[model samples]
Target: VTYSRSPASPPDGPAHWRPWRFRMSNDVWGTPVVAGDLLYVTSFEVHALDVATGRRQFKTKDVAWTMAVDGGLIHGSDGPTVYALDAAGGHERWRVQADAWVYSLKARRGTVVTGTRGGGVQGWEASNGEKLWEITGAQTDFETPESGPVIHGDTVYIWKDARLRALEARTGMERWSYPVGDAASCGGVPVRVCAAPDGHVYVVAGTRVLAVDIDAGMVRWHFEAPAVFLSAPAFAPGPAVTGGGVYLADYLGTVYALDATTGKDRWRIATESRQSIEPVLVTGGNVHVGSGSAVYTLDAVTGTPMWRFAAGGEVMGSPVVADGRVHFGSADHVLYTLDAAGGQLRWKLATGGEITGSPVARGGVVYACSKDRCVYALDAVKGTATGRAR
Candidate 1:
């Protein structure tokens, strides 16, 4: 379960390497999801592999751009058809054809909900795929990829026609709505929403960040950013709320730490390049964020730079912190493991294509997907391939 390389070894030289890589028929763009001992990934097909051995348990042509796992079922959608499969065997359990093309899919509390292309949101029974309820009247822009509904506790939050609506998760009944006004016009940048434990839900609209009271469905406070043109077409990462503060990065590579209650700025720092389309990770009193071709670590309290690790390509995915290590992928077709404390390179493994999604670590293995049509499971410490590289 471990590789022979030491932690102090240089990232570049040959070392004892063993990894398990499973190849697929098409490129993998989504991050790999680890549930129990099985790893789930999707391309033109959805494949489940053994996390420790890299053996294919099942592969089904479910063609899903969005997926969720809950209540022993794998829920996904291809166009207008929503399908639920047995998570253990990949057998079709139930399928439903929606009224329009599905834009987002999420499942929880025995309920499967979907946002459609024609401004329709429907809730279905997760156990049998039965239609439970439906709502319409909000336009979902197809150009904005981040407009998916976010489920928090028993409520589901979504944006419709420039208004943020909260719906009952199981019944699809509207609870309350808040108007975002002119801040909804952010050119083409996606709006990022995050529901925090502090009884507030944060939303990034254009140049303004709104903190809405979760219970009252009203704006508690709002912070305005400097006027600038937002022209990025990629997905913007959501804010990280923890330790009584909210940490986030703008499209211009400006990172901000704001007080969760007062919306007052604690600290802010700018990076050399535009921040990547990845979430800002705050862990171990340090903030990790990807920008241009490097991952920067800064002090969480003062926003002072700690260390920087550059990659051959842009670090477009969020860095995962686990067991005192930081793992992430890059557009250079490499998966990197770094020392969390000092930002030194532990190991680097190359895949055939760029990795746009983040890696997940469970047990002692790190799982990641690449555009090269493969999923790699590596030793968390040694960074060597272990199971089988097909």
Candidate 2:
């Protein structure tokens, strides 16, 4: 039956939708960082909660678009400024004032490097937030810089003006630059650049997928999609290289497995709808995707369908797997878990608002955040719903 006038309220859904244990009264847009005992999230304030009790450990009033942690240091950004906080107590250690919002945060070998929309990339001392080096004029032609900097070894790789530039991670000096697209394509803004254990850089930019030799900064092989790509391409897990090949999908919902060395197509599978820019994950011999309102599992080797799990709303974030189960959030204020092999619903927990961000599992517990202003800790084993041990 269709809703006549918005109905009395949302359907009750399953009783299992009730949350386990929760920390209340703040919206979370980015994924929660759980380290040792602290769960960190940023909305209008930075919150640190004890994982065992879900109790607030500390709070900082300044907020940011995202936050990250490396060991004891918490890194966060608020537009033109980035803050370094004491992870244990939310104490401000130091802060950096930059030209634009710090979009990418990476900690490498005692240095913190951040990418910004203001056409600048800056490196700072992770211990004290001191500016080590700054590179300017990394301008994008049209699209805002979406992908963050990917560092492999001592080199930093970033995209700007449709080209991929490899720079010295320590000094911000340019080593070499490879045009991902022609000058006509506005220097193909890459969706993501990932590195493999073998030292090759895998890139997905517009309709093309490229494997670059990081040392020489040269394209090893490139594969172009059969369809004209969206200026903003569909999202997939991306450039997942393992064994002998790489896996990625186009905006057209076609997933392709390419020979990692030669860029030859190994297999391709087309899904039901346009796969939006959500991240794709390949693990446990399966390729997991949250496409529109459905999540699908495909065989990693042949691209054959394994199973599909339907959700009540659009799933924008990628799913996480642990202990033979799949966990993800939906637009309809729900967190769901399923048996990885059979696509069977294990449990789903309801939330105060849309569950747009992804879920993280650690230490046998799954943690999720919602736009409605809450963070929930759920039991990963049975979903019988109890938070902490208290």
How many collisions per candidate? 6, 9
- Residue 17 local lDDT, model 2: 30
lDDT of 1 by residue, 1-390 (tens): 433445533233223423568778778877888887688888867788876567799987768877888888999988779999999999999998889888788888888878887778888999999999888865465423345676778888776777888888888788888876433475455566777777788877677788888888989888888732232111113443433477777767777887776788879898756545566888777888887888889887788899999999988578999888999999999999999989999999988899857898776578899888888877788776544455
**What are the models' TM-scores?**
0.89, 0.86
Q: For model 2, what is the error of residue 45's alpha carbon versus the real structure, in angstroms, after optimal superposition?
A: 2.1
Model 2 per-residue lDDT tens digits across residues 140-185: 4432324567666778877666678888987888888887764356
Top lDDT model? 1
